[model samples]
Target: MSTSTAGRPYALIAEFETPASTLHAAELIRDAGYKRWDVHTPFPIHGLDGAMGLRNSKVGWFTFLGGTTGFSLGMLMIWWMGKVDYAIPVGGKPLFSPIFAFPVSYELTILLGAFGTLFGMFFLNRLPRHYHPLLKHPRFRNVTHDRIYVVIECADPKFSDAETRKLLEHAGGRHIEIVED
Candidate 1:
């Protein structure tokens, strides 16, 4: 979301020495009221979401809706097949029964719930991406090992090169550098 490809920077990235420093920087960024920023670390750090001001994910709603739809459809399909389509009564049992429908409904609930989680994540995170500007940075490759970083994207409305650099410096970030598109 950089403004242009004509030498505009995609983001500003800064390195932190430890998880504590990264977490502190994230809190500072959040307190500064800047959006469109993120933290990267070698491993998941405790309380990072709170530091970044993130709430619980909405993917659970998608799972609930999908499970409900699947359960309802499963019941309807069994009812239609048993009562209207064939209408065959076996051993004097009821033609449509909740007991019989439950197995299929449970299976469908599991299947659709899984699918909803997958697709919801793809939608929410903007998946199917083939590239990112961060991947072009030579030092960024160290993220998988021992490095922790905070990256503030250029697209943020509050982004200012000088102010953001100063903020990062104040938050204990080191090796701060602009990421060019």
Candidate 2:
């Protein structure tokens, strides 16, 4: 139930050269009933979603909520300003014409959506984090380069060093290293 930095005494890094291999390794680990794992790649892989067992990110929901809020606010502002606060007759038009507010409403939708998406991503991923346990491993720089690596944290309830290493090796991992905290 609790994960302490010092309590994380073990980790395993399985390095891969190609996205295909990385996907295969991820599938194998997932099928083995290992829950606490993450994979890294140099670029996006087409079917990696299935392999990684990742669901759709919640960023879309955040953006939708934000856009709705923005639209509501925009409509409220226009209604209050033009219809209630100061009603001005122009070209014999109604006070609350939807056509007149299209531009502002559209802009607000996009504005809020963008802001919400950015903030949501940061919040969900726990960004502004200056340091990470992954950074403690030396070979992990390959994540931004050509190599793909999968790591299973020792803190998982089902994690075991011997079993994880054997599974990775059986999955054709050529370079496997232990990550120390």
Candidate 3:
């Protein structure tokens, strides 16, 4: 085992058969005063978000901000370039012809919203962290199949390996393992 996991003291790996069981395990673990834990599943389970105690994602807000910024900038650019800089008099339209700028603004809004959501999610989650001790565990490959796994890192202040194992066993997790970091 790598020394990176040595400092954690201990860690518990629990395998659950169903999404419902995984959700229940998470709730029980949280009630048991363990906070540093995560759930892995093949696909997103309905209502699992609430069970895991995750807050609403702020990516929507980021997308909205990006789209608004894009719309404003697009309008400004079109107005300055078409009306002020070039001064094109097409169909006797007004200098600040918003109708002509609608398409550009719309396109910019979509582009910004898509990119902003992608980058915002990555930023908020602090992702691209390819190396994790959990990835070293043998059973982790089952995550893509029929299994759901919950891992409680020992780095959490309120963890005792034996007690945590018992807690997981009681929570209906099967094939529980002690993972070394």
Among all candidates shown, the one with the greatest lDDT: 1
For each candidate in the order shown, give its overall lDDT on alpha carbons.
0.90, 0.84, 0.84
Per-residue lDDT tens digits of candidate 3, residues 88-173? 78787788878989999999999998988998999997887786677778888888887898888877777787888899999999
RMSD of 3: 2.6
Q: For each candidate, give its TM-score against the true structure.
A: 0.92, 0.89, 0.89
Q: At residue 43, what lDDT does model 2 achieve?
A: 91
lDDT of 2 by residue, 29-128 (tens): 8888888888878898888888878898889988998899888888889988999999988888899977878789889999999999999999998887
Q: Global CA lDDT of candidate 2, please?
A: 0.84
Candidate 3: stretches off by over 4 Å:
1-10
Which residue pairs show collisions in model 2? none
RMSD score of candidate 1 (Å): 1.7
Which residue ranges in model 2 land beyond 4 Å of their true spot? 1-10
Best by TM-score: 1
Query: How should the candidates be ordered by TM-score, best one leading?
Result: 1, 2, 3
Model 3's TM-score against the true structure: 0.89
